[model samples]
Target: MKLNKTLSLAVVAGAMMVYSCGGSGSKTETTTSTPAPAPAKEMTPEEKHKDNPDFVNGLALVKQSDCPSCHMVDRKIVGPSYGDVSEKYEITDENVERLASHVINGNVGVWGEIPMPAHPALSKEDAELMVKYVLLLKK
Candidate 1:
């Protein structure tokens, strides 16, 4: 009787261990995160923001502002990274104006249907500065 009970308990324990552990031949889960499309490199502190006062302002504002909630300076999050934007658009003065408008007005088609929300809190000048900092990341 003692041997039978020990054998039963061992079988139960073995079964529990097998059940608790992953089933055999389990497939690994794929990461849901999408990688950045561009082969953009991370820039140095001096190079990333550039020396523009506006760039500096953007670097500071980005941290305090809602920018970091979805965007990274060099990598993509919910939105494209500044590097990818720089690679896409010309860094001309006209573009600066246009992008600032884009930033303030909030466009959807450029990056995707995800839609960048408008920044009513950001002044035009601040938008321009942020755009400058982003443009500086152009590869």
Candidate 2:
């Protein structure tokens, strides 16, 4: 009787140990929470204007042309800076038309003796868009 009782207790304890350890081929799942994402950085003036159709199209036009070879946004290089041009000319319809004409037909004695080369290949509409982009660079 004593031997049987001891064997029974041992079997019950082994069963309890296996059950506690999840050894019955059952999967146990544990959940962990993920951290939230950080806030977005503030956009600059140029970035803020990215939504504007003229700004986006004009910037793309300028990038695809030789404008960067002579012109820049803030400082003068071979020609006047875009910011300087922007400050010198107001954002008027007449100014846009005049600047676009100058871009396509070329201009002399404007910024200096260095004449702005004519982009005869550029369409008037595209030239106007480019001018609009430059005019937006005002400090």
Tens-digit lDDT track for model 2 on 47-90?
Answer: 87888888889999999999999999888998999989999999
Q: After superposition, how far is residue 13 of candidate 2 from its true place, in Å?
A: 82
Against the true structure, candidate 2 has what lDDT? 0.91
Candidate 2 has its poorest 10 consecutive residues by lDDT at 41-50
Clashes of 2: 0
Off by over 4 Å in 1: 1-50
lDDT of each: 0.82, 0.91
For model 1, how does the per-residue alpha-carbon lDDT over 1-139 read when each residue is reduced to its tens digit? Answer: 9999999999999988876775464756577988779987777755754657877887777677888888886789999988888888887999999998988988898888899989877899889888877887676
Off by over 4 Å in 2: 1-43
37 in model 1: Cα distance from truth in Å? 33
